[model samples]
Target: MNIGIIPMRYAKALFAFAQDKGMEETVYAEMNQLARSFAEHASLKTILDNPVLKSKEKQALICTAAGTQVSDIFVRFIEMVLHHKREKHLQSIALMYQDLYRKARQITIGSLVTATPLSADEENRMRKMLMMDKEGTLEFKATVDPEILGGFIFGIDTYRLDASVATQLKRVKNQFMDKNRKSL
Candidate 1:
């Protein structure tokens, strides 16, 4: 009864069920919303795990957290999870479902971090360039972080290209420190 196994088992079953119902995409979106909700609200788990709160109330909270409207399939799946007292694992289940959906749909998640925001055309060009050597559709996001100082950092799936000035400067500083140590 490993903790990790519970979420994976529930997520796999939910994924298969959603696929059979042709509602996997809808459920995937709901799961992503749910995961984000959990991340943003640390007290959510504490509230959910309260034995004083009724099951129906918990269901309402879950649905509200997901979005204004969720698919019936998602509602039913949440009902089942609550029935089995697996509400505590809801966050993990949502994340695992997203992972399963991404893998099954061959969607590669990527992000670009730059010192400044790129224009629409520049962003599209960078996304296209990154996708050229990769497989499947890319779910790309562009974010601005002035802390990077300059250049950009691009990541796709498990690979990352750290061309940011901050990282480069750190590398040079480390090299100088090592050289000084060696001479001393």
Candidate 2:
């Protein structure tokens, strides 16, 4: 997850290559699923990282774990990574590829966490407020977290709006503490 330029560079190249080859859509889905598989199957990395296993064996294991859902090109992509000894960073590369795909397609993935679920009208209003424009699609996932107390936390990529009551209360508490410190 903490990968840097290597994965990003690989993902950009892959994304561009897929686009040129007219396989962007197929490869994008495969990359996302590949990243998710790494997350869902913890042992996948352990198995892949086993130096005792040959590169071909590792590639076969990855392809098997990936199943027929992935395209032949994607399988070859995995093989290429194994061949280059970059298997360990495959998860990061997959994640970066998804990010690149979303960016290219103008898809913004965001999360809305609230103390409670939003009503139909409220949800629509929130969408309007957050989306700002009609060109890009907002892929929003909603979650209820009572710990927020009230309001909502809207997050998209690196940006986050924390209007939750819990956060507000913490700010007030910090202000009060600052005031008390000055008096003392």
On TM-score, the candidate that comes out on top is 1
Residue-level lDDT for 7 in candidate 1 = 99
TM-score of each: 0.90, 0.79
Local distance difference test scores for all models: 0.95, 0.84
- Per-residue accuracy of model 2 over 1-184 as CA lDDT, tens digit each: 5467778888888888888889999998778667778989999999889999999888877766665667777877787788788888888888899888888888888889999888989878877777886458887788999999998898986789999999999999999999999999
Per-residue error for 114 in candidate 1, Å, reads: 0.4
TM-score of 1: 0.90
Model 1, range 45-137, lDDT digits (tens) per residue?
999999999999999999999999999999999999999999999999999999999999989999999999899999999878977987788
RMSD values for the candidates in order, in angstroms, are 1.9, 3.3
Best by lDDT: 1
Candidate 2 — which pairs collide? none
> Candidate 2: lDDT over CA atoms?
0.84
Candidate 1 overall Cα lDDT vs. reference? 0.95
